[model samples]
Target chain A: MALTRDDVEKVSLLARLQLTDDELNSMTEHLSQIIQYVHQLDEINTDDVAPLAHTLDITNVLADDVVADCLSREAALQNAPQRDEECFRVPAVL
Target chain B: MSSPETQPMGGTPYAVVVGLEVHVQLKTNTKLFCRCPTTFGQPPNTQTCPVCLGLPGSLPVMNRHAFELSMKTALALNCTIPYFTKWDRKNYFYPDLPKGYQTSQFDLPMSEHGHLNIFSENDEFADKQIRILRAHLEEDAGKSMHDEAAGVADSRIDLNRTGTPLLEIVSEPDMRSAAEAKAYLQELRLILLYLGVSDCNMQEGSLRCDANVNLHIDTPAGTIATPIVEIKNMNSFRAVQRGIEFEVGRQYTLWQKDKQVLGDMPKQTRGWDEGAQVTRAQREKEESSDYRYFPCPDLVPVVVTDEEIQAMQQQIGTLPASLRKQLLDDHQLTAHTSAVIVNQGLGFADYFLALATAIDDSRLAGNWMQGEVLRILNEQEQTIQQFKLSAAELGELLKFIQSGDLDNSKAKDVFAVMIESGQSAADVMAELGIEKVDSSQLEELCQRLVDNNPKIVADVQSGNPKAVGALIGQARKENSNVDPGQVRQICLALIEKL
Candidate 1:
C-alpha cells in the first residue's frame, strides 16, 4: 500500500537508473501514489474469483516450430546506436 | 571420504553443499516465440526478427515444439507436470537482453519435484538421488563479446541466440561433494542426450551450468553454514567440479577467520577463473524479488490435459537409467560395463544390444565394446553411428570365436581387415586366406605334431601337462590357421591313449 525511499532506490539500482537525490524523493512519492491508486482494486470482493494471468480469455496461443526468413545483418544493425561490422556495440559489460 | 581441504581448522568436519542450475537449449528449428531460425554460429544479429528483437507492436507466441520438448524432458526426470502454467516477465538490465526482460516462469513452473539418480564411477560415493526443485522454460539472451585485447572497452552483442528456448533445470542442494555434483551433471546430460531434447554439447554452449556452493561445518559450539556463493562461467563439467572444490576450501578458510554464518552477508556471485583455478568474486547476488517478476499479459497461459501429459510420457521412451538397468538385467553385464555402454550414448547402447543379441554372449560383447570398439571410436574420433562395421557384421565375426572356428588372435585380424575394407566377415576371412580348420583336419595336425615330438608326448603322458605347449607351437608353425586350444585338447587325448 505504501512505498519507501529504500524501495525506490533499490528499484532504481536494479533498473540501472542513475537518479539524483531530488529525483529519488519525487519518485518515491509518485510511485507510492501510483501504488495507492492501484490498491483501490483491493476494495472489490473478488476473493472468490481466481486471479487472472492474462487479459484475454483464450489459452495456448502457440505457433509451430518452423524457420522463417530473418533480417539481413545490415537491417538488424541499422537502428543500433553504435555497431561494428557484424554486431551492435555497447558499453563494456565487465 | 573427507579430505583435509573440506575440514575446518578446528578439526571439525564439514560437508560441501552444491546445487546445480543447468540451462539446456532446446533443440528446436526456430526460436521460442518467433520463426527466426535458432542456428548457432551464424553471423551476429542476422537471425533477428521483429518478435525476437522485441520491436514495438510485435506479439510473442510460444513455440509448440519447444514446450513439448520441455515436457518430455520433465517426464524423463520424473518431474510432476502442472496442468496450468503461465509465463512471467523477469525484468533485468543487460545489453544482451533486447527486451530488458526475460520471459520465464515464476511461481508456477512447468515441472517440479523430480529426482535423478546419479551413479559414481568408482567407490568415491554411492548412488544418490539429486532432487529437482523445478524446471522452467525460458527464452535465452544474446551473447556479449568483450574486446579487452584491443583496449576498446566496448562489448559487441550477438542477437542470434536471442529468443532461443532454454529449459532451466534447478536441482536441490542434495549433493555432498564435488564428485557427486559432477556425477549429477553427467547423469543429467546423458538423460538429455538420450531424450534427444537438447544436443547437450558443452562446447557449443547448448548446455551450461552454474553451481551454488557452500559449506556446513560441524563446530564444537554448533553447526555453522557459510554464505552460499553462486559460481558461474564453468565451461565444462570438470571445471564445475574443480570450481566447487576450490570454493569449498575457500569458504572453510574464510569461515575460520570471520566465523560468519549464512545470513551475516548477502549471497555472493563468483566467476570461475578456470585458468587460475579459483572462484573470484564478481558481485553480490540479488534476491528473487529483485527481478520484479510479473505475469506477462502478451502471452496466454498454457493448459495441458491429462491425455497430453500421458502422450508426452510415452514419447520420452527409455531413459538412461532404465536403459542401464536393462543392460544389466537382460545382458547380465557388470554395473561398470553397463554404465560405460550407456554413457557412450543411445546409439552405442543400441549397437551393443544388437551385437549381444546376435551373438548370445553379453560378457564377450561387452568386452569387445569396451576394449576394441571404443578404442577404434576414440582413435578415429567417430561416433557409433559413424562406425564402419555394422552390429550384424561384428556379430558374425564374433560367432567364429564362439564356435571355436577362429582363435582370438586371428579373429582380431579379421575384425581389423573388415573395418578397413568394409567387407563382411566371410569376405574378409576369404580375402585374408583364413579358412576355419575343420575339426578332423585339426585333429590330424595335432596327431602329426604329437607323434613327431616323442619326448613331449612322454612328458605329457607322465603328468606334465604344460609340456603340450611345445607341440601346440609346432602345430601353429605347421598350419597357422590351427586353433591352439583344439590342438592342445586333441594332442593330450592322443598322448593319453598312447
Candidate 2:
C-alpha cells in the first residue's frame, strides 16, 4: 500500500499535473496515507462475496436509438480555445 | 492453454504467436453516447455535440441499437454473454481523445470466451480454430489530421468520428503465421457482416486491426521467448499479413543478435511502414503510457437478460461458415464457387440462394452467377441492388434454358438485353424479337434443304452427321431468327426419311 515519491512524480506527469516540489512531497505522503486507508478492505475475508461494480442495482438502463438536436457549429466551437473555420487546431503532434 | 505450434522460416525453426485486436464501428444512426449523427466523411466538427465534445456537465447515455448490435455480434461469434457488464474509463491523453479517456469495457466485457475458425493457407494449420479472448464495446476517438498535405504546420482535430460506437474484439495468441492471421480476420469480418453488426469496411475506417506478435525460438538449453511487439498502421488484411511476416523475421534476427534482450525488453509498440513493407518501432516500453482505467461514473451498468440473449441468438441467421458448408454439402457446389457466392456479400448471397432454390439447380445457378451474371454486373458497374434482374427473372431464364426453350448463347443475349433495358426476360425477348421457331416451319425448311443439297444430304446419310451444320447455316441464312438447334434436329429427321 506504500507509495514512493517517484510514484507520485510519475502519476503527476501522466495526469499532466505541473506540481511544484513542495506539492509533490506532500502528494507522496497524502497518496500513501490514502492507499494505507484503502488497503484495510483487503484484510477482510470476503472470498464468497462478489465484488460490487456499481452502487445501483439496476441494469440495462439505456436510451432509445433516436437522434436529437445537436449544437450548431458556432455554439459547439464557442468554448474552444483555438479553432479555425471548420476544426479545432492543436500544436504540432508527432 | 493452447500454444500455437512452432513454424520454420528462412531455414531456421521459430514459433510465431500472433494475436489481434480489431475495432469495428457499429452501424448506428447516432453516436454511442450522444445525439450527434454517426455519419462518416462529414465536415469536420459538424457532428460534434456537447456530450461528444467532452464539454463540462455533459453525460453519456448508452445507445440501445449499439448494445443490441454488439449483442448480436457477440452471439454470432458464439461468445458467452454474462448477465451483467459495465463500462470503465480508459484514461489516456491524446489530441484525438477529447474526453482524455475512453469509456470502454475493462474487467467485464459484453462477451468473452469465443472462438473463430479460419481456413489457413499453410498446410500445417489449415481449418484451425482461433480462440477469441473477449469482445467489448467502446467509443471511438476523433481523428487528428497532421496537415502535411495543406502545407500547414499545425494539426487539426476532426471530432466527427468522436463517440462513434465500436466493438473491440481481442483474440488469443493462437495464430502461428501471417496467413492464419489474415484468414482469421477474413472469417471474423464475414461473421460481422453476416450479423449486420458493422459495415466492416477497412477503407472507411469502420474496421481496423492491430496485431500483437512475438517469437519463440529453440536454443541450446531451453526455449527463448522474444518480447511481445504490438504493431499498428496496418490498413488492410494484406497489410496485416505482410506486417506480421516482416515482424516475425525482424524479431527473430533481433533475438539472435542479443539473447539478453528477451527478458529485459518490455512490450514494444511498432508501426507498419506500409511503403517500406517493414514494421518500425514507434515507442519503447518506458515511453509507453499507462492508461489508468476505472469505472465510468456517468453511464450505468448494462444487464442483459437471459431472454434477451435468447432473442439475439435467434436473431443471428445462419452464419457464413454453415451456409458455405450447406452450399457445398447439400447443394453440391465446389469450394471455390461456394466461397465466391458466400463472399458476394449479404444481398447477393440471398439473391443467389433464392435463385438457386427457385430453379432447383444450385450448380447451374452458381455457374450463371459466377459466369454471366457476375461478368455483366462487373462490366456495368452495378451491385445486386442496382441489378435489374430479380431472382425470379433469373430463375425463369434458367428454366427456359433447362427446358430446351432457349440455348445458352441465346439466353446470354437475352440477359444482356434485360440488363440494358432493366426489363424482364420475357419483355426483353419480345423487344429483341427472339423466339423459338415453330416445328412446322422448321420441318418445311428441312425438306427444302434436303431436296436441293442432295450431296450434303447424301453425306449426312452416309454417317457424316457434321454435314448437318452447313444445312443449319443455310437455313439460318434464310431466316436469321430461327433456332439453329431446332434446324439440326429437323435436318436429321429429313435425312432419315430419305
Candidate 3:
C-alpha cells in the first residue's frame, strides 16, 4: 500500500518541512502512485521465494589490525558550519 | 522458567519478543549506487557528488562493486538471493538527506531467509540461533550533529556520510531475552566483518541497531499482547541490551494493567532515552508504514546469475563457523578453546589455522597463539601481520619445543625475544646463547656442582630435599648451556653417593 495523506502530512511535520498545500497534495499523490507500482512485487509469487539480504558472497575482509591514526580536533572540525575557538558550531540541527 | 510471560504494550501476561533490524555499512572502497567516496569522518560534503547529493537532474548509477559485495555477504549468511532484484525510492524527509527521499530496496531486497548462530555467556543458556528475515540495500543519510552547549541549542549537519551503501538486515523476533538479541547482533557483526561486506562500525554509524520489541503472553484462553515498541538511537551493544531490557519491563508493566489498552493487532514505535533509562513512545507504530516504494527507473535491476552466485560463494573463504568446527576435531583444541580462536576475526583465525596446518599440534598452537600471540598483538596495539611472527615462523618455533631444542621456559624466552626485535626464533636461541648443552657435558657439570656442595647432596640423600632444585639452578648457571632435565638426572645420581 502507498502512504496515506495523513502519513505524508505527519511525516512532513515531523521532518519540520515548510510544505505548501499543493506540494503536500502532490507529494501524497506521487508517493501513492509509487507505492501502487511497488505493489507489483505482490504478483511475483514469492511464497517459495526468500528475501535477499546481501548481494556479496564473500565474508570477512578485515583491515590489517592497525591503530587508527587520529586527526586533530581542528583538522576534524575544519569544515564545520561554524567553529568557535574550542570547537565546531552550527545552527540548531534538531 | 516458572514465571508467566509478560505481554508487550498493554495486554495480558506476555514475553518480550525482540526483532532487530541491523544496518551494516559495507566496507567497500566506494559508496553504494554512486561513485562518491565512502570514507567515514571525511570532511563535510567533500565526498558528495551529484547522485549522492541528490541534486536535481543527476541520474543515479549503480556501483557494481557494491552490489557484488552485497551479494557475497548475503550468500555467506545463507540468505537466498532474488533472481531479479531492484532498488526502490524510500520517501522520507530529514535534515540528513539532501534529497527528500532515500534510495533503498523495498519489496524486492537483495537477500532473504538466512540464519545466524549466536553464542551467549556459558551458563544455563543454550547457544541461540536467530532467523534472518531479509537483508536490503539502501543509502545512508547524513548525520545531525548537536551543539556541545547545554540544552538542544544549535546543531550541525554533516553530509559526508550520505549515500554510504548500507545493508539493513532484519531478523525474526525469535530472541526471548535481550541477551539473545545482543548475542545475535554480535555474531551478525562478526559474520559481516568476516565476509568483508561491511565494516559495521557503530561509532561511525556504520552498524546501528533498531529493535522492534513486543511481548508474547500465554493466557487461559490464549496469549494476549500489547503494542510493539520500535526502539531507536542505541549507539552500542550495551545500549541495545539495556534498551531491550527497559522495553521489556515497560511493556510488562503496561501489560500487567490491561494489555488491550494499546489495541490488539496494532504495533507502535518507541525511542530509547539513555538518560531516562526507559523507552519513550515515538508514535503509534504504523502497522505497515507505506513508504511508496518503487523500483528506481534510473538504475537497472541487479541481475545475478548462478555462476555469479557461485563465484561469490567461491570468494566466501572459510569463516569462523566452519573453521571452528574443523579446529575442534582435527586439533586437540576443546570446542570452547577453538571457538575463542575462531571468534577473534579471520585474520587471527587465519594465522592460527595456517600455523595449525603447517604444524602437527593445533592444541599447543591454539594455546600459545590464542594466549601469547593475542596478548602480544594487543600489547602492541597492532595486527597479527605486524607481530613479526609469521604463521610459518611461529610454527617453526613450536617445532623447536617439540624437538626439545627449547624447553617451555626457553621457548617463552625465545618467543619474547623474537617478538620484541622481529628476530627469528632460531637467531634468538643462538644470540641469547640458550642452546642446550650435550647430555654428557650437562652430566659432568651437574656432577661437579653436586661434589662442590656436599650438604645439599646430603639433604637430597636423607630425603630432606628441594636441595635438588638449588643444585639444578647451580648447574644451569655453571654451564648455562646445560639441559635442565639432564642436569636434574645427574644431580640425582650424585646425591645417591651421599
Candidate 4:
C-alpha cells in the first residue's frame, strides 16, 4: 500500500522519525493511494509463477582483486553535517 | 532435536540447509537512475543528483549498463533468462534508502534457476555443486555514516553510493561450510571480473554478502531446527566465515533446547560483530519481508531474444572453473595447489600462465608464484597488480629455475635481487655466485660425505638403501644444487663397491 498519513506516521515512528502532525497526515494519504494502485497486480495468478529477481540473464560478474584509490580523510569528511579530524560526528547511537 | 553438550557428538544424520543472497553493484558510468558518476570513493554527496537524492520532481530513468550487467550476471550464473522481466518498487522507508522505495525486481525478476559450479579446494572434502535460485537487479542505498570526528554529536548521510545499480543473487540453500561459502564468493567475484561488470569492491560496499545459516537436528519424527537467522553486510571473507559459524551454532543450540522453530519465527536478520565473533540481532520476525511489491509505473519491462542470449554466451570467455581444471591437468599441479592458484583473480592466474609460457619449467613458475611471489605480496598486503616486480622479470626468474645453473633453493636468493633490481634472473644468479656446482665437484664432495658418515655408509653397505638418504641430506647442506634423489642413487652404488 502507498503510505497514508497514518501509515507514514506509523513507519516514521518505526523508523524513529520526529515528524509534525501535518507531515504525518499528508504522508499517510499519499501512501494509501499508492498502495491501492500497487495492489491491482494481486488479481493476476502469480502462485505458479516464480518471482523475478533480475532483468538480465548475465551472471559471473567479478571485480579485479586490486586496491584502488579511496577517499582522503578530507574528502570523506567534506560533506559531513558535523565532523572531526578523522571521521563524521554522530549522535549517540547506543 | 540436538542436545547442547551432546549435539556435536551424537547428533543424528541431519541435513544442512543453506540459502545465500548476494548483492553486487553493476559497472556503470553513472548511478542506476541518475547521471551522478558511479565512481567509488568520490567526495561524499558531491556525486549525488536530484533523482538519486529523491528530489520531489526527479524521476528515475534506468541506466542501460545496469541492465546489461544484470543480464550478464544472470547468464553467467547459469540461470534461466526470463523472456520478459520488469522492475517493481519495493516500498520501504529508511534514511539510507533515500527514495523511501527501492526500485527492485520482484514478481518478474531478470533471471532464475541457475547454478554455479563450486568444487572444494581440499581434496579431502567431497566436491559439490549448488544451485543459485536467481539473481535480480536493484538500486543501492546511501550510507548513514556516523561522524568519525564528531563521535558524540550528529549523524550524516553521504549519498555517494545512492542509486548504484546492484544485482541481488539468491542461491538455493546448499552450502555446508565456511570454506565452501568462501569458494562460492571467490568464484562469483571472478565471474563479475570476466564479464567486466562492477568493480565489486566489498570495502566500498559494491560486493557485500549476507550469509543465511541454520542447523537441522535429527529426531525420530523428523529432523527439526530453528528458523535460519541471516547474517548481513559482512565485508571480508574472514567475517563471512565467522558470521556463519556463529549462526550455525546458535541454531543448533536452540534446537538442542527443543526450541527448533519449524516456520516463521526463527528466521530473522542478524548483523556480524567481527571483533566479538558473535552475530548480534539486527531485525526479528523477518522470514520474507512484505514490501507489498508492485511493478514500478516509471520503468518498462525488459525483453530479450534467444539470439541476444546466444551472442552474449559466445562472447563470454573462459571462467575460473574450466581454467582451473585446465591448469591442474596441463601444469601437473596438485589439486590443492591449483585451487590456491585459482583463488587469486583470473588476471593473476593469467599472469602466471603468461610467465610460465616464457620459462623452461612451467611448474617452477607455478611453485615460485605459489611460494615467494605470494609471500611478498601478502607480507605487504599488496595485490598482484600492485607488485613492483614486472612479469618480464618473473619470466627471467623462471628461466633460472629451468637451467641447471640455479637450483630451486638457490633460486630464492636469486628472486630477491630480481624483485628489487629488476634484473634478469640469470644475471642475478651470476651476480650472486649461485651457479650450480659441477657434477664432478658434487661427486667429489659426495665421496667425502661417504667417508665422514661411515656408520650410515656401513648401513648402506649392508643393503639398507634408506641410510644413503642421510648422506644426501649432508651433501645438500653443503651444496644446494646437489640433487638429493640423484645423490641417493649414487651413494648406494658407491657403498656397494665399499
True contacts kept of each: 0.96, 0.78, 0.17, 0.12
Tens digits of lDDT, candidate 3, B1-498: 333354445544556678999888877666665656777776555566666656678876666677777888888888999887877777665667777778988888989999877765464246667788998888888777777766757666666677777888899888878888888888888888788777777877789999988777677777655677789989889999999998878776766676563466566767878888887777554334545556566666666788888888999887777776788777768877787787778888888878888777778888887788888888989977677878998888898888767777778888988888888888888899877566677666776787788888778888866678888788766666566776777688767765
Instruction: List, residue by residue over B349-446, the lDDT tens digit for candidate 1.
Output: 99999999999999999999998899999999999999998899899999989988788889889988888888898888888788888988888888
By TM-score, how accurate is candidate 1? Answer: 0.95
Q: Tell me the alpha-carbon RMSD of every candidate.
A: 2.4, 3.6, 7.3, 6.6
DockQ of 4: 0.13
Which model, 2 or 4, shows the larger lDDT? 2
Worst 10 residues of 1 chain A by lDDT: A47-56
The reply for model 4, stretches above 4 Å from the true place, is A1-94, B1-13, B123-125, B147-154, B177-179, B193-196, B255-260, B264-267, B285-289, B380-382, B386-401, B433-492
Tell me which of candidates 1 and 2 scores higher on TM-score: 1
DockQ for all models, in order? 0.90, 0.74, 0.13, 0.13
Best by lDDT: 1
Interface RMSD of each: 0.8, 1.2, 9.6, 8.8
* Candidate 3 segments whose C-alpha is farther than 4 A from its true place: A1-93, B1-14, B148-154, B257-268, B271-287, B441-471, B481-498
For model 4, residues B1-498, the per-residue Cα lDDT tens digits are: 222222466565555556778898887877777666778876566666567767678767777767777777788888989787788888765666667788888777889999987765555235667789888888898877654554344566666788888899998877866667877887788888867787778887778998887766667877666677788868887888777877777777667676647684656888898778888887564223446577776666677889988877776677777878788888877776676777787777877887777775567778877899899889879888888777777877666556556656667777777777877777776777666677788778878888888899878767688877888888878876676666776777677778
Which sequence of candidate numbers ranks them by TM-score, best first? 1, 2, 3, 4
Model 3: reference contacts kept, as a fraction:
0.17
Give the per-residue lDDT digits (tens) of candidate 2, residues B80-151: 998989999988777889999989998999999999888843365657788899999999999998878566
Least accurate stretch of 10 residues (summed lDDT) in model 1 chain B? Answer: B1-10
Q: Give the DockQ-based CAPRI class for model 4.
A: incorrect
